[model samples]
Target: MPTLVKRLLAALVIFLLLVVINQYMSKEGLFGFGVPSYYARLIVLAGINIILAVSLNLITGFTGQFSIGHAGFMAVGAYSSAYLTVYYAQAWERSLGGIVGGSLAHALIFLLAILVGAIVAALAGLIVGIPSLRLRGDYLAIVTLGFAEIIRIVILNIDSVGGATGFTVPGYANFLWVYAFAIITIVIVYNIVHSDAGRALVSIREDELAAEAMGINTTRYKVLAFVISSALAGMAGVLAGHYLSFLSTNDFQFIRSFEIIIMIVLGGMGSLTGAILGAIIITFLPELLRTLGPRLESLLSSIFGADNIPASVHTFLLQLANYRLVIFAALLILIMLTRPQGILGTREFGLSWLKRARRRPEGDKPVGTGGVSIAEQEPPSAIDRAKEVKNQ
Candidate 1:
């Protein structure tokens, strides 16, 4: 089959899957079965985090630039799009709803909002990248981090969007929209990584000075990666803001930026699949740990008999659960010590691994077979090739 047809089929399948998932996530059951709201919400948020992580990977991972201001771009997207939807979306939706169906109108408006958020975030990235990107190592990190805090502080004082209190906007995003964009972000980053520009970006990461010496225009590519990363982050923010139906400066705190950094680092800085895995782990790990206390208590009670278990022991177990963050930190430290390169270490998870597994070892083939043995197959030496060339 043609690649285009395959892509279209894949797209259709993904759309249908998302639709089924959205229905299951809704209050009303899909075919009498539905996921609990809590799980559904977690999945949606995880998708958003995936976008943020993968985009950050492009700049910091593939392009070799350290950036901690992703949350700032996210804030820019959230508030700017929120400002649009709050003040203008209704009128435009009503006007367009009459011409097109209500559903289409709402989607159109939200898409416009997403575009606005992305563009504005890209502009913010450009503004920040131009000056700060010139700096390298810890200085660049400090500048990006400072810029993120500055954006957060500035947003805190803007009363139009409710300032410190927060801003509420229409709920126009759901599982389908969020995941669709998440997939788009992944595809974008993947293509960019595999393309000529991706090669240039990787070159810059490997050695910026060497890339510049080769006339690769290091600064332009760095800024491009930064802008693209920022824009995708903004899009994630738009989805997040619209899905949550609220925007808060508190959500875009410096810690949030750090969390994004942690996702990429924990996953493997240069790996796309690693970023995604990291995002999922980061988003769900804390919640998963929430059950540890009760489970541990139950296990101890079963072993010692409930009557024999001391109140103090139970108290300690509960308290330990509360200290899960400390545990989480320890786990991260352990991972870093054992596998500092990260879970994947710049490798992707795919069918290629299977192909590698199927390959035969060199010299393993029988000599009697029609195929030439690896040990017997040889190329002409360099000297022989040079003599032949001279003779020719």
Candidate 2:
């Protein structure tokens, strides 16, 4: 079969699987099998974070731009899409429902909202990227940070989006929608990272001056990466808003941006899989920490008889839950200190990496047969040289 056909078939299979999983996650169980709401929410949020992390990685990791304003772009997408869905989605849904059933009409409206969010976010990225991308390192970071703060302040002042009260939106996003976009984001970033344009982005990251000298249009690529990143962040925001059925400016604060940065950094910069793994870890770690104390107590109770357990030790373990945040921070610090380059620095996890690891050295064997390699071959003796000359 053709590669395209195979890909389409694979996509179909995946979509079918997602549909089943979505059903299983719903309140009405799929054949009485279902995931708990707690886990469902975590998985959905992880998907959102994956989108954010992967998109940000395209610009910050692959393209070497330091943007700390992802949340700002997310806010733009969430609010813009929410506005449409709040005021116009019902009417559009009603009109389109007649043509394409209600279910699909609702989905179409959400898709339109996503498009609007992406476009608006991309515009914001372009506006910020053009002037700010000229500066490098700290200066660029500062500019982006300020831009995010400005956006938050602006949103707070806009009463239409509910300002301090927050905006309530319809729940159009679920596990399927969130993960679909997450997968799309990953594929888009992955394709770009492996393309000629991706090479230009990397070149700029390595040395902007050299890339400019080589006619790589460093600014153009940087801005492109930035806009694409922003657009994706916006899409994530739209999903988040719809999933939670609410939007608050406080949720898109600078701290949220830092959390995303931590995800990429902890996973390893310049690595797509690293970003994914990092996002998952960042999403789950806090929740896990919340239950750590009970888990530890249970383990100890099993190892040492519960009757033998010390009251002080039990008290300490129970109180551990209260300091989960501090412990979470400490764990993060420990990981960073130990693996500053991240768990996978500039490396990916896949079959290709395995193949590379098992490949032989060029000088370890002969060029074809079981003889010495060219670099290791012995020099010809005087008799061999004489024989060659006589034969010629």
Candidate 3:
């Protein structure tokens, strides 16, 4: 088949799939198969987290960098995007409203804003990755963390972007936009990891010195991974900022960075599937706890009789919901102790599993007499030759 034909077919298939996904996810459905509004929001948030986690995985998992300031790049994306949408969305509404209408005009406007954010974030990645090339392990971690703090502080002091008061973003981003970028992020990261560059990245992770000794440009590849990861994190930040319709420096604080790191760690550092799984679990866990806490408190109150319970106890019950981080931390500790490799542990689930099943394991070859490899021995040409060999 011609390459052009193959490319066209692939493009067509992707377009169709995107259309189908958009329809199914929309409030109105083709076959009455629309998702509920509440679940839809969760899915969107999960998609954003997935992008964040997967990008982080490329740097930390595949490239063997232990960065903890990912949230800083996200902050760069979020604030820049938010600023554009909030401050400049009216330009779109005023100029393009007649052509694209209010909604789509705003979306296009914000999409451009998001691109700016992503670029800024990628540049920030270069800023951090380049200066700290000689640093490794905790030293690099500290540098990244410092960079994130610097970003947050800079945002906090920027009077035009709401300063410490924070900025309100237009609600231009939705599930469709979020999921679209998420899928793009996954595809890009997956392709990078599966390519020759990915091997070099992984080799750097395995042993930087050895990879360098083999003539691999370790610093360049590491920086490339950093920039890509940072850009994707920025994209995630853009989605979040637009979705929430607000932005605060506090929102992109160090803890947010840690949460992203935790997601990658919990999901399995090097596995895309693991990143996704970790993202889902991490994103939903707080909601679950917050929801469950009240129900459990009500059950306890009802069972024990409300009159018998002290006001202090009631207050404590309410506060229990806020301890989700503590609960999450405990769970993380348990996971580390039991399955240190994470849920997937650098493994993925796909057609590759089927391929593995079909091939015999390298260690499974049969050993003949005197430890000879049966695989290496050829059979007799004829039955008479076999008989003569047996007689000998």
Candidate 4:
């Protein structure tokens, strides 16, 4: 079949699959045990993580910049979006009274919040990227880490926006909003990566000095990558904040930044598909572990006798709920030490490889009207060619 036709068919199949899954969840529940709401939340979280990972991969993986303050940008977005939603929702409620209380107004407010969040985050990215990107490697990482902490502290002090006490946001984050943002994020990143600007970014990643020597403004591309990545991270934060319907300073912290970095690293940095896969796996793995924790505890109690089990064992098992960070850190260390190129490395999965593999099975054929094969008919050694020319 033609490539275009194949692509269209694949897209249609994906769309149908998504629709079927949505219908199934609506009817039979997402977890298959009648708890569709929880599964829906999980899917939303996975989408947000995928956005975070893929966007950050553009900077850390493609541009070779160590950004540790992505969560700060996310915090900026979340607080900005939350403030807009709460403030506007209240104003709309007061102005329109009962007319604006339904799903339509809520949907409008949610969109407004997303826009506000993205703009706020992009502005924050500009501020942070300008000064912090002047440094490189560990210095850049340290600056970003400090920036994130500063954002958290600032959020904590803002009383009007709930200050230290978290504020409740309207629960307008449904499957539609989450998946839409995720799709937009993915599409934007995909386009950017395939553009000339993306090539410049990759060149800078390969060698900043060389890129500069080639007349490429390395600083400009770096800042551009940072801004785009930060904006996407902010979008993810908005979705997450609205989904939870609550916002706290703790939600956007250094640890959150590290978690995003882990997703990018595990996914293979520059690979977009790897980013999505990594995000889904990382986001769902903790939930899976939580489910297993109880069974493991029960088995241990049966083996060791429930009465003899120490209280600390329960505490230890409970700690596993938060121990995802530990696992993430260990996995990162292992990757860095062994396979720093990541799971998929820098190569993208494409159909051209399959075509090339198929061609390889055909082997060599004889040249037309000659005993020589195609390979043998090629130019001889440079010196021999030169000697033949001289002799002729």
Better of 3 and 4 by TM-score: 3
Cα-based lDDT for every prediction: 0.93, 0.94, 0.87, 0.82
Tens-digit lDDT string for candidate 1 (135-160) = 99899999999999998999999899
Best by lDDT: 2
- 1 or 3, greater by TM-score: 1
Where does model 3 exceed 4 Å of error? 1-38, 99-104, 293-322, 351-375, 378-392
The candidates, ranked best first by TM-score, are 2, 1, 3, 4
In candidate 2, which residue pairs clash? Answer: none
User: Which pairs of residues have clashing backbones in candidate 3?
Assistant: none
**Per-residue C-alpha lDDT of model 4 across residues 135-235, encoded as one tens digit per residue:** 98999999999988998899999997899898788777756567767877888888888999989988988899899999998888999999988888888
Q: Which portions of model 1 miss their true places by more than 4 Å?
A: 302-304, 354-392
Scored against the true structure, residue 237 in model 2 reaches a CA lDDT of 95
Off by over 4 Å in 2: 352-392
Worst 10 residues of 1 by lDDT: 365-374
> How many residue pairs of model 4 clash at the backbone?
0
| RMSD for each of the candidates | 5.1, 3.0, 5.3, 5.5
